[model samples]
Target: MTRTLSIAIKENIYRELRKLVGVGKISAFANRAIEKGLGELEKEQKREKEQLRQQLIEGYQKRTKNKELQKTLQVYGEIPNERNEYSLSMVGLPLTTDDLKKFLPVEVYIENTPTTGLDKPSKILCDSPFTWNKGIRFKKRLGVVSKEIIEKVKRT
Candidate 1:
């Protein structure tokens, strides 16, 4: 269900927005921009909450009963049911660099930080740097190359 919303803003700002996104797109542009701003604010709040959770986990690990944690896990409310004893790790997907590299050619280098691996510089046997996706665009070709590299490494 959708309801029409009416709100007022500065005339100059509204004019500028109209010029940028056009009148027909103002509602959608405003919605996306507002939601992105809200998402950033929520990310900071979540970061703080995660920090506190980490501290609690650290404190629990320091306990002498950390070794014999069956009853301790129960006391900490970690035992979810009669069978389960602990919580699972939350996964942020699309593979970490360390893991993803295993699927790629070793001659190719990947940027270590802020991992959009496809945007980073890499090379084939120190030939020249290129973007992961565009530079080394041949996945099928690289698979053969990678296997050869592995076989050579194993023999040596």
Candidate 2:
């Protein structure tokens, strides 16, 4: 049985297909390609379904019994979930040469201690000989800065 069907395809792909397979045989080539693609899709779906079924069976086999559940509950009532917060509470301390030596090559936020006449705190990369004074307090920066920002800071 033969049925006429019209479909839209990309010009480049259509041109290639027409060049490879003549207009008279285009329908046959497309039919074979679609059947092969559908077969592969069906196989993939079956594989996924079997994988999910195996996981379900394994889950059922490993499920804890009522007694084991009760024992776990007794040992730890309403267990708290794991916390993943990465924030640190760092207190600012007066900047000293000793601290600069202690935490060498660390990124720090240096704040002017009112007497330095500086406008705002600056993020600094403490690789070598840092300019320090009695009127400066420093804290380690919690987050990372971009390479561009680092370069800009270095330029100044």
Model 1 local distance difference test score: 0.42
Model 1 clashing residue pairs (backbone): none
- Per-residue error (Å), model 2, residue 148: 83
CA displacement after TM-score superposition, residue 138 of candidate 1 (Å) = 42
Q: What is the C-alpha RMSD of each candidate to the true structure, in Å?
A: 18.1, 19.2
Candidate 2 clashes: the total is: 0
lDDT minimum window of 10 residues, candidate 1: 71-80
lDDT of 1 by residue, 116-142 (tens): 223333323322212211111112211
Per residue, candidate 2 scores C-alpha lDDT tens digits across 51-96 of 7656754454456354332221111001111221211111222223
The per-candidate count of clashes, in order, stands at 0, 0
Off by over 4 Å in 2: 64-156
* Model 1: residue 91 alpha-carbon error in angstroms: 22
Worst window of 10 by summed lDDT in candidate 2: 72-81
